[model samples]
Target: MYQNYNNNQLCLSIPLEINISSNHVAVAISHFVDSIPDKLIYEKAMTSGRPAYNPAMLLKVILFAYTRQNFSGRKIEAMAQENIPTKWLIGDPDTVPSYRTINRFRSSDQMKRLVEAMFLSFRQLLKAQGLIDDSALFIDGTKLLADANKYTFVWRKASERFEGQLDKKIAGLYQELVQNKVDLAMSDEAPKTDSKTLEKTSEQLTNEIERLDQVIATEPIIPGGSPNKRLRRKFKHDRHLIDSDYLPRKRKYESNNAIFGDRNSFLRLIRMQLLCA
Candidate 1:
């Protein structure tokens, strides 16, 4: 069918305010802030340092920013400038707080107990609404966005025994499958690089990609009627990833790392852990 993914860009425009207001995080945080006793925030209010931001509004921004897995002051400032949801939480489109200001506010003793109290307030609100009872509230890690060192995340492989040799292990597994004479290819169409993939190595990632290439030289990747549709779709995508190419620069790697962008092949890195197991 018409090769694959023929992308065409068309410009579309809409009011930015609507996008901000519709975000559930913004709405919930706004409601939560509004529900808080104003006296709690006003009690700690200071008259120093320029006209201050409304404590409730500032608290809402910090908490909402934390929910999006963003903990860095600089990142929050950047988001305030660009993220619509963040702007909505701030209650002003033009006011992006400085990183230093966000840092000071979040780290200050005045605010240290505020987040905890906010959670308690939320629990109370839930109880009042009969959504929960007086019993202990459970932590949903996703909502909490528990803190971690941005530089120190543990990749899934780090939990496995062969963490360091993860890539090589993947190569070995795919190599074994090749030796066992298994047919991993289905598409007769040429392997297409449809997504921006981070480079695992300068060379294209795995035997599956090379094998798929060899097959595509003779056939198109045909969709299979595997009983497990998800697995089938996953395999097809992994096969395409195999035939992809590595990026050329460190700049590309940084951009890719930020979003954990697609990679030329992760199937080997992923499947290798399975085989090694």
Candidate 2:
């Protein structure tokens, strides 16, 4: 998802005569944009302080950038400024948002809604064009490498940290008990325990228990969420063995191997039949 480039590199520019077509992603996004209910999403923006770019154009540019895996607002802005296809798609070669604004917009709920709407529209269009055969479907999954190392796997760390925290809590409780004993020894009267202090300490212990419970419940024994939920649930049922026997050993080898398998790769392969009318 990240690319490295040397800015100091210079090359001789040569003009070659070759036919190049418009970007397919851009075209598809443009069609989706055109089909959006603009009045619903754009009406509010039109009355704002200064408005120039339409929702369709902005949505198209954002989607195009996303398809290219250029999710960063700064990268998108750079592409808009320098890339011909991006510029053409936006219909504004001159208009480019600052990285800050673009980032804010990208993170907004409105963008999510727009993307969902666009996807639905695109799916409907494809269906109308007889591009989907709903009779048969294939599903599969592959592992995706997290942006972290094997050492970063926190399950073991969490356990160690939890043990240390529990030790500290016990030590604190011991100190409180010692203090109570000292107070009782110094005075003939029975040492009075502060009810509020006891309640607060109890609450802290309860909170720690809740925290541990959450961590245990949500541990990555299996991935959970939409497309992968079924697979994840099945794996969860077998998690104890998977984690103890497979994951640890496999992760150990994988961490040392330079050539991580397709599981670590981002590439996806999907093939479906298009039934044309």
lDDT of 2 by residue, 158-207 (tens): 44455455445434543554543322132324322233333333444344
If scored against the real structure, what TM-score would every candidate get?
A: 0.42, 0.42
What is residue 68's positional error in candidate 1, in angstroms? 1.1
Candidate 1 ranges with C-alpha deviation above 4 Å: 1-23, 135-277
Q: lDDT per model, in order?
A: 0.58, 0.57
